[model samples]
Target: MGVGDVKRRIAEILREVTDEVWARVAWVAVDLTKELIRTGRRKIAVLADDVFQAIGLHKAVAYVKGLLGLIEYPPRSVDVVVAVVATSEGLTRREIGRHRWASHRPIWNMPRDGFIQLYGQIPGGKPPFEEVWRATGGNSKLLGELYKAGWSAEKALREIADERKITAFVKTLRDEERELLRRAVDDPDVLFTREDIPLMERLADLNLIVDALPERDPWFWAGEPPPERDPELGIGRHIAWQTPLHREAVRRALGG
Candidate 1:
């Protein structure tokens, strides 16, 4: 979808999923105020992905002030469009430099170290912009794609990958989100949701995990491990722990 459509869709989705509509409505009011300042009542909407890419410190303040000043009265449904751009491919240098908005400024060309310092001036967490740029060989779009696929710094170092999308993707998720995914992959029945299957399918697309079973049951796969009991501690539960070596062997078997 285009940027505007993406933003609108995210807003709509957020509203749909929100149990507390009033809280979200309040935020929308703030967003509308910002919109007025930035676009002079032409309808204010910010693409989430683009904000991560282009909106610098100075511009973000101006955008916020503009929006806040626009709202005279608070009790209303304010439309705050948030577009989270989740992609599979890492971004290219050119992609990062691309300006989708008319008022946005060109990225300043600074030495690597200096630019890192410049990034510190911006708010929010350190998004690994410089690190990803350097890691992906300066391909920003490709970097974004890797993020969408649940790949990590360690995994990225070991593989070359691409970008594709599932029908519905959550753009607001972050790198640490993989922990939840890992849990779901291990035990899918934990908490079921429509998004769970689509994301799981996407992981399968990345080839990080596969679906298969051995042709025949071998000794190890045939039965559970032996249970042990301690004399002092009677009838303690038998823990099943796969050692790193055993895990590696299984990984090799699985074509890791």
Candidate 2:
């Protein structure tokens, strides 16, 4: 398919999914606004994944704002699109040097329990949980890529590493992100105190690390942080590799 066809298909998928969401959850959204408005609520959070990559931030936000303006209601809820990587006006962008939305919200990183739910749906059968976890680290993007191979999950992971994606990622790294990703292979937990927040914010915005807190306490992975460290630094949560697979890829990229 040409780029135009690909974009058209994506639009079609989004339109279909939006329709489905409205059909099923529109009432919930309406009720939520109504009740929340009664209580003086003003923010309606909408997550737009890859919005920056697919369409520039400005246009995407304008489109969403237009949608919000059309809502016939009294609560006056404003839609706020949180970013995976946004520009200064709080919109996700594909470019590397954008000021990330608000590093407050955690992006997509499903824990192990989520894998069980996903496993049951696969056709051939879920591979061993440990192997799957090791290979993908609950990263939906990598898992989706691996799932397409139709082989056992382990085999798929072993066979098709994204050399191109890794190459692109390598080229984008600056001095700091490169150093951070390099260290991540040896010690996955990035302790982000107030001092590291700026760097952490940038890294998180880039989808390099994610907030790993209360969810995976006492984590038992290859480079798990010490349990007591987070409390001592007061860094809320230890930032972790987006995926073990990515970390492994980085290790190879960094000549580890």
Candidate 3:
């Protein structure tokens, strides 16, 4: 079906469930959010924040417009706000993104799980899904970068290592950050130390690294004293290369 057809279908379905009450009035509010998400073109958190604002403005509009028209304001918009309010209260971004509110939102189509779930979605996804998951850490932007590589570990690594954007980003890095990347060339999971704190923050700002988990340290180190989880090393939050390809790319750029 065409996009218009899909939208009409959704509107019809909602109309049926709206019981001719306030829900019809809510159509505009939801449309506002859909437009912002489609046009604002932001990350998940920023999108969610915008959705919150859109819903608020929608509420004020519905109230004033209804008062002016001498019509009873709909209660359905309140239901929508309930969803956004829940997010503001404490819901994780993933949890909020999974709400029914996203039935027509593009966030659902984003690479939340990367190839772990999308390997079957796209044709010719030959590389192991596990490898892609490890390499990109489910980061949508990074996954887009490697999409042309078509799922081979070697190809993904090669693409990252040769990607112009990757090289340009590396060139912008400081010598200390480059040194960190060179060290992670083969040791992507190296536990960041207190000493590497500044460098880790610098790399994370560029999406080259991500917070991992303590369990990823090593089984052999099980008997060793667990390193103190310090905020400096992002303790309680494991730190590592966002993608193995990123590690290799930076490493190669540093002439490791």
Candidate 4:
């Protein structure tokens, strides 16, 4: 859908969504998180992409904004926070720290056991959902489409060709793929070969590129930069502005 179409749909969803739908999404995400904990995973990192699909960002962000307010003065549970908050950015450590009125202290304690029981009890609204959906829901469809199209991360990354929006973190890579790529780059003696399919696959998953050698391809290792460049190499060299004596008029313009 075009930007206008998306905006209209989101406005509609916010105006008409029921509490049942809200509860269902929360339940699914919480259940998945609980399972991760059960499997001995200490930290359950959920990508907000799925929730953004279900609910638009304007509504989602509003929900989170409401939750944050409730969390401060009234002290809401983290599970409730997850239920209302759809995007990952809202749940940052800084955000959590800013919610000062919460009766319950924030918990980041480690060594959490396999059975970490956390309860969530908070009602929706007390804030409008439409506002939250608008901010976070825009890219939901595109991301979902790429995943459905059998596009690898590397493929998506290459096709998109913009790292600023996508490469927010390195954990986007799968464990095996990360290991393979790390090994390929770190060991100079090890030539990248067909055997490195898994590594290539991983990079593909993250939307990065790794062109074939092709007798000397410029893109052989395109996305990655050489690791050993000196930090101070560019020290004390050129002037910030490229003008000799500020070029007559330029100096007058700056009131120098």
Candidate 5:
């Protein structure tokens, strides 16, 4: 059946339920509808049946409520969004959306107003501004922690590195992975290719390294500037330590 018909049917089934139960069911239905739209799925009937069969109506309602209760409230969401903006200052709204943790909500949807500020414009887009998301002075400590090193380049490095965390991370790496990290530490200016993506991605997942564009001019933020390209690094993204402290921590962990 069509999505509308499926919703009508579900509503009919839920009609006898109290307003509280109906509200809970409606909340889940909205989330499910969004997921279906996002995935371009058409089998609404199948989803409806599965939802009913997998968990009875009563239990499903309770489950969703439980999950909602577990979710930390608003400012936590604001913190995550701000942290991302702080670390990656030059990202466009579209680029920020690529981060899995960043919700579909607007960047300004924060507990405290004026948490983020735009710096300059980027050419050729609806939101023409590069939407350089920078945390205001209030979030300076967080900003410092995420983007500690370098003036011009958008280094995804953390300002402070916890040695114990680094040690634990090292223990989890395979010998080859450890060796690769050692190479990164030994050659901070190391260049990587497509062949290195898998390893680089692993390190990125561990928050040790990040793949980013080459450094921009320190003044680039002051005005609209053409994108910078590093011929030596070619067109591919460059890999760098997540933080200078991370590099130092890794060096110590690797016995450098």
Candidate 6:
């Protein structure tokens, strides 16, 4: 359906619901519609789907807006880049550009605001720290939550891994996928082959796992000139739990 039609239908649906229900849910759809409209994209249908899905997930509209406001609003390119770096540490600029929502422009020129740190300096006449990028401090916390939430406000709200939601989400996983999550919990460094790509991607979408490099110690960058190593050496990705709490919750759900 056309974007206008989608909006009209959403309005009609909202009107049909009681005032109490409308106060709780309809405003979310309305605000999301306004946000989508500002992007000038014909994605109202998708927004409509997300709105109801969010309601079904029992997400508060404030929770949804808070997460989206942090990572998906105006200047989304910068936030997207930040989230990419947040989720996967030790990424080179080239690697950051490879993510779904990332672009070369943002990678090259985005403001770091002290949230992002680039390591590995080049000798001369080159872009600073072409080697690896990492998100720092509270920015990392917020971005990691937003990223692990799969950029979905509904998912973000549920990321705390409440028992009921975790169980509900776990029930939707395929056998192999559950096995994979189990393996990851047992060995955060678990390796996967080409055949596992689709499963890994799906699990990633559910915010159950992330692919990341080993974290570098703060002392590694403490010296006068700081230690320099070949960024290529440790760039291999490893499967990891999105958070310790998420791991524990999944473990309980999997009965491990």
What TM-score does model 3 achieve against the real structure?
0.41
Report the Cα lDDT for candidate 4.
0.32
User: Clashing pairs in model 6?
Assistant: none
Ranking by lDDT: 2, 3, 6, 5, 1, 4
Error of 6 at 152 (Å): 25
lDDT of 5: 0.41
Candidate 2 lDDT, tens digit per residue, 1-256?
2335434544554565554443323223334444544554455443333433334444554434433433444454545422132222112422232324322323334556776688667677656767766767665566777777663554443443353355566667677777876665566565356655665555555455554443433344323332333322122336565566545655676667
Q: Which stretches of candidate 3 lie over 4 Å from their true place?
A: 1-117, 128-134, 137-177, 185-195, 211-237
Record all residue pairs in model 3 with backbone atoms less than 3 Å apart, i.e. clashing: 127-151, 212-238
CA lDDT of 221 in candidate 3? Answer: 30
Which scores higher on lDDT, 2 or 4?
Answer: 2
TM-scores for all candidates? 0.21, 0.50, 0.41, 0.22, 0.34, 0.34
* Candidate 5, run of 10 with poorest lDDT: 77-86
Among these predictions, the greatest lDDT belongs to: 2
Indicate the worst ten consecutive residues by lDDT in candidate 3.
82-91
Whole-model lDDT per candidate: 0.35, 0.48, 0.46, 0.32, 0.41, 0.43
Q: Of the candidates shown, which would achieve the greatest TM-score relative to the real structure? A: 2
Q: For candidate 3, lDDT tens digit of each residue in 166-208?
A: 6777788778777666665555445368777666555654545
Candidate 2, which ten residues in sequence have the lowest lDDT sum?
Answer: 82-91
Query: Residue pairs in steric clash, candidate 2?
Result: 86-91
lDDT of 4 by residue, 1-256 (tens): 2335434544554665676565445434444444444444443344333354355533544434544443343322233322233222222322333555322221111111211111011132221322212211212333343344453334433434343233332346566644543443323122245676544434333323222222222343222222221111110111011111111112222223
How close to the true structure is residue 42 of candidate 5, measured as C-alpha lDDT?
A: 32
What does candidate 1's lDDT look like per residue over 1-256, in tens digits?
2346445744775766543543344345455445444543433444332331233433444444433334433234445433222212113212332444312222211334544555456454445764543443323333454565464554443333212221122233454444555343333332234555454444433323221222222342322222232112111122111111221222332234
lDDT of 1: 0.35
Indicate whether candidate 4 or candidate 6 has the larger TM-score: 6
> How close to the true structure is residue 154 of candidate 2, measured as C-alpha lDDT?
48
